[model samples]
Target: MNVSTATVSLALRDSPLVAEQTRERIKDHARAIGYIYNRRAASLRTSRSGIVGVVVHDIMNPFFAEILKAIESELDRSRQTFILSNHYDQLEKQRTFIDTLLQLGADGVIMSPAIGTPPEDIIVAEENGLPAVLIARTVEGAQVPVFRGDDAYGTALATNHLISLGHKRIAMVGGTDQTSTGRDRYHGYLGAMEKAGLPVDPAWRISGPRTKQGGFEAAGQFLALKDKPTAACCWNDLVAIGLMNGISRAGLVPGVDVSVTGYDDLEEAAIATPALTTVWNGQREVGRQAARALLDKLSGASVKPSQELIRPELHVRQSTARPVERS
Candidate 1:
């Protein structure tokens, strides 16, 4: 006989409404047949979908890919499915995707907000009774928990390394003064230069899109300068690689003439022609932490709204060295 899961559950629980002999026989048959209960069905019966929504700024970014992998693994362990959306750095697109997820009945959400996204969306998510955790980037006025790597510290380390190599006229390519990560990293660079008593020239700094083409164009601008910087620190590995390409096209060798540094330490950074020197942000660890935080919230656990700042490590490679004259 094909018994329903509810009937089996009733039998297993030995409900007083069921005859003793029938309950015992059903339980014995279930055990013998290795019948397994479906948690999703049970959750649906209790009015839950067991679904989560995850939104990333850019899915093409290797860092985000790693983070997504960790989140998927964690959710799988909890028997929850996730719907992922890529914002492509567009705030409106992000908002639409969020709304769609909510309409589709996601139990909760985790997001890396698009740059310059207002805090009101986060407030709305909370007001709708959907717990949301911010990862990598946090909104200015959002009360949601945030988890991110220490951008300031990572930039400071990169700047100090260049300074130690006798590069006083260093340029920062990529990233604007808009997002908190960009602002903090710029501040860290400024702090390092000031502490070293080096002159900070605004002309050496270039703020633009964080894409490879943007980096290439910025590198061209810097290379055309009458007084080009001896070293350049890019916002991320992709930018650094593009900068390297632009520098080469300008008849300059990357490590030999102008040193380059990048953040994130992505896989391509190490495999590039001159092996980029970069800061490792521990993307996987950041992902794991975000997933854990979201799961805690889903389990009705009291989680304090706090920031988790992961320290970055400097990975030295062929891309940086002391000034040619100094060597």
Candidate 2:
């Protein structure tokens, strides 16, 4: 039996205008024919697209990839679709992506803001009644709900662990004054050193991009120093691995000659030569929370502009150890 589009529509909507027997017959016929409803046509009637946008700063990072997977899984349960874009930590790219998603009629957006981008653009988007939530990293003054890991607390834990291993002259790698995460981790390292009454030398602190190459270059800089630190705290696992490679090139063994610690505990951290001692930030949890916030907004539920911080866990591996002798 062939079913008409109008009959199928009525059946799908469960319209009272259709008799019970007719609706059942239409539904059965539609299913038998493998007929799929046109979501766009349905959206035209209800004015809901059931689409969300996700903007990530670094799509290349495995951690972000994992988080994206979690977001996709959660949204799948609602039969909603998401559009994805990568900002590459560039403000212009982020702005363009957001505008494009808006033009594409995204119901809401979940974003990790580009480094140094002001929140004004996001504010404008929200003013247009577009619900958005910040994930992983937040805009400075945006009223959007934010979900991220506790950077300071995590860094403090890593640094304290190094200190407990009798590493007093510890160096820091892969942080700059640009991003809040970098600044927070740096401050945490400083705070830990201060609490232990350990003096942090200016030469031991290095600033570079949060990339593998950046970590490699920073490690070379540290090796060039006359008074080298026995242990180094890196921004992330990628950086830590890069630093380890550079240390090897400089004729030193990572776990033996110079202990290293990393953050984020990316998958590669566990497979590194010495394995990396790093902090595990709950990236999937951040993604899930951000998705939940955006879904709440899309469902016309009231959601406050609140910040949720997920605690981080330290994974101690073979990458770090106590100094063999005093510096």
Best by TM-score: 2
Model 2 per-residue lDDT tens digits across residues 194-273: 99999999888888747788888777788887778899998888789899999998899998889999988888899998
What's the TM-score of each model vs. the native?
Answer: 0.88, 0.92
Off by over 4 Å in 2: 1-7, 13-20, 28-36
Q: Global lDDT for candidate 1?
A: 0.85
Q: How close is candidate 1 to the true structure, as a TM-score?
A: 0.88
Worst 10 residues of 1 by lDDT: 39-48
Which portions of model 1 miss their true places by more than 4 Å? 2-5, 8-44
TM-score for candidate 2:
0.92
Q: How do the residues 54-155 of candidate 1 rate in per-residue lDDT, one tens digit apiece?
A: 998778777687888988999999988898889987989999987886665678898998887889988897787678998888788888789999999998
Model 1 clash count equals 0
